[model samples]
Target: MKTLDFIKLDEKSVAPVVESLKQLLADFQVYYTNLRGFHWNIKGHGFFILHEKFESMYNDAAEKVDEIAERILQLGGAPDNRFSEYLKIAKVKEVDSIACSDEAMSNIMQTISLLIEEERAVLDKASEAGDEVTVAMMSDFLVEQEKLVWMLVAFQSGKCHK
Candidate 1:
């Protein structure tokens, strides 16, 4: 087996971003589960619409989670996936409480907003450290999260209401 040496980050330089990435992964996992919950439990005039949107968002979140975890592993760090560790590190809160359409939209917006901030922070650190790979990953995530935020905002604004 051959290992690639594509990354130029030293362990010391990568430490903060790796820690931040771990936190982001944990937050995203919780957000993903919450999206699933909203998808399953959402009820209102826009039930089908919200359900489908939640599913799409959750699916994208799941992929991002995988990507983050894999990046951590590539950096020779462990990917924190345990719920206990997630609870400790995640900035996003888990929502087990059922919510109405407006409440669910609010929750989704809040989660996406937090993610946007976290992703931007990671991108900034990556850029400062000249870590192109991390910056690229963060950029991709930023686009996805921005789209999710826009959709949730539109829904909350009744622009997407049908």
Candidate 2:
């Protein structure tokens, strides 16, 4: 018997999907932490702009963290809430506190890019198993993240004029 049985989504097919989602969840947790560090330590001329951006990003990340965890639960798997587990499983490595505006933006771009890759993996797995729910979730995530990549790239390109 699975928690998702009522929804017609068996736990068997979702096992692999749940595993992938766990990895994505862990990556998100680490990314969220890095965003917090950026928000707290960003300095210099772009401090005001970057600081607010980082806060908004982390706030969004926090919501995503909850969504991922809830998704895991819906798939009949336990959400790994432990930071220790996140550190062990996440490929998104933690960064030291960043004060430089350029460094902060660079980290955001890099980490979010990696996140896009992971989201695609999850989407692929969900699609494979005919899991429309998870597929839609991952699709939504990918679309939003891709747009974020575009905006960040635009921001980085504008730095050339300086």
Candidate 3:
């Protein structure tokens, strides 16, 4: 008899999605850390506004980290709980102290851009594997993050609310 992991499809097909999800989870952790830095270290002209925004962003990222890990478990894969492991697998590198609001915004924009690309790839893989739950989750993340990317870019360009 086949293994339970192959209940929905061949294990081979689901492997890529699981791997991609792991990487995405790692990236989210890095992003969360950076947002925390931004929230705590941010200073200068927009400190009041950006400090609050960073707090919100980090909170959202925290939720995504949990959701991603739970999804991995749902796929019959163990979620890596080690920061050391995440550091090795994550594409989004850890950012050190950054107090400038503009610099923080730029960092957030770049990180989210990379995250959006990864999410798209994961969405495709999940769709190909007929994993609607993963597909839907990724879709929701993409929609939200894409808007954030747009707003961050707009803020950088002075095209949005200052």
lDDT of 2 by residue, 80-130 (tens): 989999999999999997889888888888898888988888988888877
TM-score for candidate 2, residues paired by index:
0.94
lDDT of each structure? 0.82, 0.89, 0.89
Q: Which pairs, if any, clash in model 3?
A: none
**Which candidate has the highest TM-score of all?**
2
Identify the superior model by TM-score, candidate 1 or candidate 2. Answer: 2
- Residue 39 alpha-carbon offset, candidate 3, angstroms: 0.4
* Worst 10 contiguous positions by lDDT, candidate 3: 1-10
Clash counts for all predictions: 0, 0, 0
Worst 10 residues of 1 by lDDT: 1-10
Q: What is the TM-score of each candidate against the true structure?
A: 0.90, 0.94, 0.91
Q: Is candidate 1 or candidate 2 better by lDDT?
A: 2
**How many residue-pair clashes does candidate 2 contain?**
0
